[model samples]
Structure formats: structure tokens, C-alpha cells
Target: MTRLGVTFVATLCFACDARMQLATRTSDLDEQLTIPSDHDLELEIDDALGKKHREDLDRALDAREPGEQLEHAQLSQLALDRQVFTLDDLFRVGDDLFAYQFRPEQGLGNGLAGHVGIEAGPGAAPNLRRVQQNAFGGPDAMSCGDCHAVGGDDGAGTLTQNTYFRGDGDRTLESDVRNAPAVLGLGPIQALATEMSSELASGRAAAIVMATTAGTSVTVPLTAKGLSFGSITALPDGTVDASHVTGVSPDLVVRPFGWKGHQPTLREMIKESFRVHLGIVSLVDQQAVRDGRVSSSLYGDGPWYDVDNDGANIEVEDGMLSTMVAYLSQLEIPIVQPPDDPSLLDRFARGRAVFDQVQCGTCHVRSLTLVDPIVVTHAEQTENTASPTVAIDVARAGMRPKIQAIDLIGSAYGVPLFSDLRRHEMGTELASPVEQIAGGAPIPKTQWLTRPLWGLADTAPYLHDGRAPTISDAVRAHGGEAQASRDAFVALPDDDRSALLVYLLSLARTHKLVAP
Candidate 1:
């Protein structure tokens, strides 16, 4: 068990008519967070919060009227004014309210939102039989943090927690299992993806214009952060041909969020995850269902406002969604921990050289420097969606140093996130039976975005399916474009192989302090 000392600062807000001051209190407790432990650390931490605070939270939750929206800003002000809350109270209240275990009396109704036969609305069917079949059905887990709690608090999931999709409720042979990836360093990844997408789109657009004006076909090379996504051929007819496009979407947008790189932004990913994994439909999806843009069958019944018919709307209102995204957007990047022993340091250095010599660095490009770190706030349009925004204090959100390291070669904000963020052919062995359509085109199951290795040391049971028990197993499992690299790794001398593994293990990330 890990013991953490956390302090909370109470601020008095007088700007608004409501005079509130967050009450100040201190408590020393053992915080069970991160790594594999013998005990149920999460439950222990929750129990450690004491009965009084838990009751207060329960009362506050019960006080909310059904269908009423919880104003994040207002609640935050109240929390600060009340000062008797824990540090978790400040961040988890608005974003993780529904994440807590709920009882029937609390309006959650048996606390199993995804159980089949639960009436959604008037004459509506029970929650759909299949998890991930569509939004508002099957409920894989109770909360987002539940699946992502393998290595640590908010870490990746284990093989047991792997989500099975495209099948009946039972784990049938037809189901496809997807290993949950860690959510760390996603803020920088989103920023890098946004930049790469803009660059690709701009380059392709220019090529099209030039080709049309010249009355000749022009090939535009779509390259960003040292990764090439083949090229786009612009014909003289003012139309673009994407037959040569290898990696990204035809629109040249780089979506680096999902396993297939389908989700474009963190906010979008959060909303979709809420709907698909937890059956917490967002207001946007609800409206889409109401407008017939989405099938009403996807969600159960008639009362569109309360699709799940769980008494409260509890549909992950826009404010709650934005707050969750903000929390995710400010997560710390994986830090590379150097070995304390000199001999171990020497071995790690040798392994890093061996890694580069074996050509594994080709797809796993070490770092991509950002000209300017993209700061996504609630007030700005970060993605293509029209979702409502909320202003989040980045400093207060608990983030490590924005710039992980400096890339002199790239001369930008160095992000040592060991990935090119481009899709690659992963060969038949890793390919799925079904195809995933993205940006109006069918994506081959074998093609996937290169998995970033920044937090590789902590997140184990590697690969998209958590099939590999060790790092070496994951390397050996690599095929297609990485076949040559895998072969080289296999052929390396024993000492070199050990060095390489040591080097990889150095890439670790620690949990961030919710409060100082």
C-alpha cells in the first residue's frame, strides 16, 4: 500500500452574490493507488474517506432534483467555500459524481445501469443485449476509471478487464476483445494530433489547388513529426484521389485517440466512452436520437429525456462531460525514470543504442516537438464539435511539466512520447476479422496506429488484446511493417537484448498529486 499526504487549500469566493468559503481541514491517510497490490486498494481508499464525508456527499447527490443540471462552476465555488472537503472532493465531485457506487434510493435503481430488461421508457425494450453494440446499451463497467485501473489509479486495464464487443452479453467466440489503453499523456497526444491533422489537411488542399491550376496531377507528401502518411494525388479536374493515401483519413486528419485512431479529440473520446462503455448517454446523443439522426432503437424507450429511466436524467450532461474532459486533458505525461545504479545506467544506455540500431525507432519515433503546446480550455473550440465548453484551470487540474523534454532537432516543445501517431499495417496475425469504418472509408483490421511506449514500463500485458505477458513477447508478436524490427530484435546478442529491455523499462510514469 502507498501512503500519500495531500493538502487542500480553501478559497473564499465573493465575486458572485453567494458568499461561500471552502472550509479548511487536514487528514493523514494511507492512499492505496497504483501498481498491483494484494488488497482492493481502491475500496480501502474509499473507506478511508470516513462515514461523515460519504454521508455529506450522498446528501448532496440526493438533494439534486431529477433532470436538473449540476452547474460545475457553481458547485466548484461551493466546494471551495465549504472547505471541509477532501482534495478529491474538489476534482471528483462534478466529473466523477456518477462514477461513485449508487444505491436504488439515490435514484440509480439497483446501480446496474446496463442490466437487460431494465425499462428505458414507455414500451421501450430492455437495455440492448450486447455491450458496445451501440450507445446506451449493455454497460461494460460502472465507471471510466473502473476499466482503466490496472497499473495504477486511472491506469490501463488488464486482460480480465478487457472489453468484449460485437457479441451477445456472454463472452462468446464471436466477440472481439479490446485491451483498454492507459489515459496518461493524452493531453499532449491530443495537441500533437491536432497539429498533425492541420498540417496534413493544409498540404493536401494546397496540392489540389496547384494541380487544378496547372492542369496536371500533383502528388502531395503528407508528412508530420517525421512520419509519412504516403501522399495525396490531386488531379487536374480539381478533385483529389486518395488511392495513394496510406495512413490517415482521406481528409488527411490524424485522429490519435482510439486504438484504430478513430476519435479525433479527448472530449469526443470521453463522450463516446461514456455512451458505449458505461451506458451514460450524453445530451448530444440524446438530441440526435430525438432528431432521428440516430435510431431510437439504439436507446430504449419514449421519454427521450430519461432514456435509461433511472429517475434522474444522469445522462452525463454537457457540463459533466466537459469537466471530465478537462480532468483528462491535464493528466501528466509519462516520466522516464533513470536508474540510480551506475552499472544499471550503463546497461540502460547500451539497450537504448541497441533499440535504435534494430530500427524499432522507425515507427516508434522518440519525440515530436510542439511549436506551441496547445492549451485546450472550456472557452475555446478545440475540436470540430459544437459541444458546450467549460473553463478549466490547467494548473489546478494536476499536470506535470507541460514540456517533458526539449527536442533540439525539432526545435519545438519536446514530447518524448515514442510514437509517430500514424497507422501501420500490423500483418494478418494481429488483424481482426471485422473491418472498422472511419471517415467514410473501411479501415483494414491489420492497420493500427503505432502504440506509444512512453508509459510502457508501467502498463503491462501488452498489445491491443493484452496477449503479451512480457515486453519481449509484445516485440516478438509484432508483424507486417514491424516484422523486420522484430527479427532484428530476435537476432540481437543476449546482453544487447537484456539492455534493450532495461532501457524500455526506464520509461515509467508516476501518479500525479491531486493536491500539494
Candidate 2:
């Protein structure tokens, strides 16, 4: 929320007769401005957003084209102008959140508005979805709530499917790859980040809480209310989401999307779906030029080559993009309350305190400040500048989300949710490339986000790679940076160990009671 480094907080939209389109080379500046190292955590917190901070951001934005600059300016300005959210604002963005709630049918594998046929794909085909790839066997590009819910939307809307992806080839795939991990206690995790950053003057989490910083970039446009990201892949046709390919591929355990497998965040996975499933692209993805794989007719334009002479049209389904983004950014990760049983609650409280004490919370940050839900103002030419800024007052505002508990869907929760969110050489023992990483050292691979631990009781079969079978097994497998924490965990007495496990389990329930 720190104005990309500016001191200014609020500014009314100013009208301009000319559409200012400015392009500046921000790559260097961006490379220069990274999450500064944490000497004293408190100092890092205080410096999250400082006037000098915005200066660095200013240099970056000023270099961009005017349009990009304006977008950067407005988004930065808006971040400052908008107040850091209270718990209530966390759920609903500009208006009542419940207004945007969907009927059971409209989520996950279903089409827009709960329509059945509208959301059809190869994943829906029983034959294609059943193939197992050992750790790699399962559907590739699946959606968030697909395997996370029970029974595909019973009246209560919990994912009942314990469907798991079978591993293929030679590996002993321990990952499930095709099941629903309940979304119970994500609130506390988000809150953890919020609490950490709240102490700093700038109030921004300086630590890297994202999956990867490899090609990360942030921009706030004047006409847009929130963030827009580019697509992950656009290959083998306009298909974006991963196909339900079986046997021939590698371990499905690499599919981190759910307890079933595949590890993709809503932000990344959804955009992929938009491109492949719906054929839509946000402004950020406009640069993605497709080649001969697709036709210009799909995008309603001449075969204008964007980057390479790839004959594919770069058109994206506009309506789905905005709505889906709205749904995701606004989608509240459920909340959890402490258990009523005194013994259980006490165990949870103690574990919670110890979780932070051991520095596990550093990597598994609790909360992240999301920019307000953005409403993209698409105009042929720059239309009415005066009233172009529209606050998205969706119906789903009343539903206030708070921390809740959920189960560690896979086997890696024992790692204290401390994930680097970057691909590390897990060694030949467990290494499997979920995504291709052609650049830099090490083989191409998909990096993963640290799994937040607000809810640990229900979600199981943890870890991005999903190699562990049980919590203890997962704990034993921790290497790399997590070794110290794992050692600390293993060194505890039986009671202490049990207490910690209990505490971890306690974090697994949803606490917030959303407005119906």
C-alpha cells in the first residue's frame, strides 16, 4: 500500500485532453529495487514505505511510457489513499462482499454462472482425468476449488472429492494431485503477514511472501482499480489451462493446485485458464503474441503479430477476465477461531506463540495486503477521464473474512509451511519438473509459494512437491533451509512434540462466520 515509494496519499482524478502514453525502461530500476534485506526485522518493517522509497518507484514509473506511467502513478496513489484494511475490509473490497457470492454451481469446474456445458474441457472427461503418473499422474491445469471441495458442491459447497492423481513412469509419486484441500483457515496466515508489516512505518511486508520473484512486476493503472497479470502459457492452440493428460507425463505430485496435486496459485492458475479456457488476456498480457497455433479470427482482429511472427491471435475473453479477477482478489480465504475445549485451545495458543518464536512465521508470513479490486476501464480511445475511475461496488461486500482453520492438504505441512517459493534442487530423490524453466541455472521448473499454515487440521498431504505421506514423515524429509526448524521440532520432548503437533492442528479451522 505504500505508494510505490511516494509520500502522497490522496489525489482526485484530473482530466486530461490528451492520452498520455509514455514508455520507460523500468527493468533496471525494478532489478535495483528489491525487497531490501532484513537487518533488524523491525527496521525493515518501518522502512517498508518511506518517501525515499517512492522516489525509487518514481524513477521506475517515470521511465515507462506515459500510459504505463499514469497507470503506475494512479495505482501507487490509490495504494496510499486507500487505508490499510481492518479485518472486515479483508473480505469485501469496495462494497458488501456477499453480494458477489456464487451459487454452488458457479465455482471451480463449472462454467460462468454455474452453467454446466459452458465449462467443459478435457479434464471433464473421465477417461482423461483417471490416468496416473506416480507422483506425476493426474490432471495438469486444474482450477483452485476443483479438487479442494467435497462432492463438487453439495448444498454446503465443500469439495468432497478425495480424487487423487496417480503417478506415472518410474517414480514413487506420493502426491495426491487430484483432491480438494479445504479452504478453512487461511485468514490467520494472511493476518500473520499483516501483523508483521503493521509494525513498520511503511507497513509493507519487505520479506518475499510470493511464490517467485523471477519475473515479478507490479503496476497500477489510472483507469484500473486493481492488479492485472500476464498469462503463464499460450501453447498447442489457444489452450491455456493444463490439459488432463495422464500416463505419458511425469509425476502428478508436482501438480500443486490442490490436495489432488498440481501447485498453482489462484493468481497464476486462473490467468492460465483465462487464456486457454476462455481466450482472454489482461492488459499486462497484451504483449503475448501467438504464432501459427491460432487464428486472428478468434480475437476479432487481423493476424497482427505481437512479438514473433507467430500466427496466433492474442485475443482474450474480456468479460471473464474482469469478473474472474474480481472473484479471486475478493475471494476470502476462510477464517478460523480457537477451539472451545480449554485443553485444545491452550495447546493451540502455545503452539501459535512458539510458531513465531521459532521464526517459522518469517517465511510463512500471515497476511499480504492486496490492492483493491480493480475495474478495468477499456475504451477504444481514452474516454471520459473525469469519471473513468470507478470503484467496484460488487454485491459480495458484506461477507467479512477473517482467519480460519483448514487441513494441510498434502504431506508437507510438517515443514512449518516454510517454503522458499522458489525451485530448489530437491535432489534427484524428489525432483520433478512441473513447469519448464528454460532460463538461468538449474533445469527449468515451476517454483511454488510457501503453503500458509493458518489451517492445519483438515488439509493434509502437504508440500509443494507433495513427497511426504504423513505430518511426521514430512517433518523428517525437511532439508535445505528448513533443517534447523525441523531439528528444533524433532528435538522437543514427546509431550512438547505432541504440543507442537496439537498446536499445528489447532491452526486448521475456519474462524470467520461470513454474512449469509
Candidate 3:
């Protein structure tokens, strides 16, 4: 039941023209796209040769300047006019982990426009030396791919000017929280997203995000436009979901993993990937740095951002945090489905024993192990050659590689496996006080986190902010702490939940990477 592919109009038209500023067909704002009559999304734009890229989105929204704005020099002139703020070979990585920013035609485009970013408007002021990090412990933060991106092609290469900050308010977030979660196909959805870790109950139950006006401080830029990445709305069954962000508090529901989900593994979410998305700081000794409580009046003054023109004042050192967590823990998860069929591997081993006789294997737990492949080859030789040791010990001693654990034959070969990496409560009839975590609280509109369910039959409008679509309407829209595992998967019998939805549409698959 998973075959929805015209390759989803070229992966949602290259993820909606690289997430936002839509209307593609090589858009230059393609007649400022308005098709939405609830377009529901299929996106096609030709509108008569879309008046040829409207002067390249009006010279990329009138290129600004404040010590060379949106640095990496405007994503290298929008990747020399292939356009849309360039940096898209779908995040490359070839010449042996592209030897730290290689050069030739400079294909990796100076480390992919040094992680793409530059929109100084919306009242734009806060660059206070690129607001380093405060994360948990709070205030001062910046990590939208530290400009726009980092590394891939079998991974390791992020270093967008190492920055840091710790504890002081008015908005700071670099205690390394991290939220990338879009690795394409993550090796058969890392064992069908850890089959919901057998009703977890322990992994330290994290997710905190406090500070609602307590004397009114302010400083929250990670971007999705001013810090509010959760909240969708509209449901009396019209299904929109995600809606709970007012003074938040039920232990902070961040559940995206790390600095809160406290690392249950994506190899500890790729060793807290470059202090969770570019606040830098990663030698991998792990945790310790605290100090907070200011409230207001603290914006400039001290070593922030003129980084070096000898206007003097230095202090930065994330140097691409262990090469962006060794090119994101050796990326290569994209398997989606290739075994091709040996009687569909005996009906995926009889839907892997009816996904462990429902209880969805208690918070989706199955096989485990992956955390030490010599700390993932010394975090990919400390992210490409500052040399932390790389011989690949005879190809990891004849391919011992780990990161696997899937189910439903590894998501029918791709995603919807169901999760358990941690974080769940799922009740306020499926809550959404606008998603958050890390102390400020409010994460239990039935608190959620065990939702990996890889490519759940080709990315849809599902939970964790997508809200449910199918798979029995996301198991009858599961209720609080998954209402006794959705009434034990609705008392199974209908041909064992139709053989567990034919073992979750045989865990569909697609993206590919594998080469070490």
C-alpha cells in the first residue's frame, strides 16, 4: 500500500524550493505562487514559462550589506546563478569526504556556502557576533546550519566559523539541542525508527524549555523565523494537529533528540552533532558549562562577530565541531528496500512476529548496540583531517559497521517503522500547546517522541507536527501515553490488524548512500 511516487514531484519540488519561497519550475517567485485552495501539495508551476525567474527573486531579495551580509558571501552568489540561494547538489560529498572543503571547481562550493543564511530583515538586528550558544542553561544561540549547510556524500565537513556562548538571558540556546531530522532515508529508517523502544520508561525522560516572561527578557533566533518551530492547528477531524505554545510547561516536549532527549542514539544522535547544529564545541568529552539569570540589557560589548579584520577581539572555536559530528555519523542510512524478495523475506519474517505481538514492541525496541565503532571512527577522523586518526582499521575490521536495527523488513525497505528513541505521553487527546522542551515545559498534549516510523509510506501529513493521515489514522490518533498502545492496536484480530498493515506497507524504501 506504499507506492505513492512520481518521486513526489521530484521530492516535493526539491523540498518546496529548498523549504520556503515556493512556486518552482525554476521559480523566480513563479508569479508569486497562490494556487492554494488547500492545494494539499502536488506543486507544478509552469504558468507560461514563469516569466523567467523574476530577476532571480529580485536579486535574492536585494542583497544586503553590514560587513558583507548573509556571509559565505551570499551563498557564493547564489551558487553562480543556478540560483535559489544556491548550495544544492543536494548537499554533496565525494573526494574522500571532500578533504575538508576541497577545491577543484570548488564543487562542494566552499563547504556548501559555509552553511547558508542571510535574511537580515523582519527588523533584523541581532547578529551580536552571530549569537553563539546558550541552549539549555539559556540565551544567545544560532545554528540554522550555521549559514545554510554542512557535510555529506558519506559525510563530515561543517565549520562555519566556530562560535560559543553560555548562560545569560534575553534568548540563548547553544547547550547543543540540535533538530536536523531530515537525513533523507537514514539507513532503512535506523531499524524502523527503533520500533518504539519497548515502552521506554527510562532513558532519563528529558525535554525542558522554560522562561515565559519572568521579567521579560528576549533572544530566540534559531530560525523558522523567530524561534517557534511547532504548532499546526485545525482538527475536528479535518486534521491539522500541533497546537500548544503559550507559556509552556509539562517537562518541555522537545523530543527531536539531544540536549534534552539526552541522546538515546543516532549514535547519540551523531554525538550531539556539532554541539547540536553549529554552536560548534565538540571534542566529545561531553557536558559541563553553566551560568544564567540576566533578564535584559545585554546585547553588544565583548567579543561578538567582527571575528577578524583585526578590529581585534576573538574567542571562537567550534571549528566545525568535530567536522560536523564526522559528517553526521557517516550518513549512509538510505536503504528504503533492495532485498527484492525471497518470498518477501518470508513475509518480512511474518511481519516480525506481528511486530512483537503489538504493544508495538513496547515503545518500539528491537536490536541495539550502535555507539562504538571506535566512536564512529573517531567521529569521522574528527570531521575530515584535522587528523584524529583514520585508517578505517581495514575497513572497520571487514565491515562491522553498526547503525541498523530496523523492522517491517526495515520499513518495507525505507521509513514507517514506528519509534521509541524516547519522549512520550501522547494524551491531551493528542496535544500541541505548540511543541517545546528543555525546562520551560508544556510538552504533553499527550507528550510525544517515539515517532520515527520511517517514510511512513511516503512522507505525508503525519504526527510530530505533520498530524496523522493513515496507518489506521495513526492508530486511531493514539491517546495519552498511547492509550494502552492504542488499545493494544485495537484488539488486533482483523487479520492481525491486516497483518499489521501488511507489516507497515512493507516498510517502504528509497534514498541511498552506503559507500564508506
What TM-score fits each model?
0.76, 0.43, 0.29
- Each prediction's whole-model lDDT (CA): 0.64, 0.33, 0.33
What TM-score, to 2 decimals, does candidate 1 have?
A: 0.76
Q: Per-residue CA lDDT of candidate 1, range 1-516, in tens? A: 011211112222334222111111111111111232445455444434643365455557647852222342213322333346433443455334434543322223213344456544322322333335522335556556777877675688888887776555554455666788988877778878888888888878899899999999999887876678888899998898888887887777788987788888877888777666665666666666766777766655546666556554545555455556666766667866555443465576577788899998998888877665654634121221443334333323444534443444534676778889888999999986567667777778899888999888889889988989999999999999999999999999999999999889877876432311
Over the full model, what C-alpha lDDT does candidate 2 score relative to the true structure? 0.33
Candidate 2 local lDDT, 117-194, one digit each (tens)? 533332222112333333222332233333444311110122233333334422434433332344432222222222
Candidate of highest TM-score: 1
Give candidate 1 misplaced runs (Cα > 4 Å).
1-99, 102-131, 134-137, 301-303, 308-314, 377-397, 405-411, 511-516
Worst 10-residue lDDT window for candidate 2 reads 17-26
Better of 2 and 3 by TM-score: 2
List residue ranges in candidate 2 displaced over 4 A: 1-145, 150-268, 274-316, 357-359, 367-398, 402-429, 433-435, 438-448, 465-469, 509-516
Number of the top lDDT candidate: 1
Could you tally the backbone clashes for each prediction?
A: 9, 130, 95
What does candidate 2 score on TM?
0.43
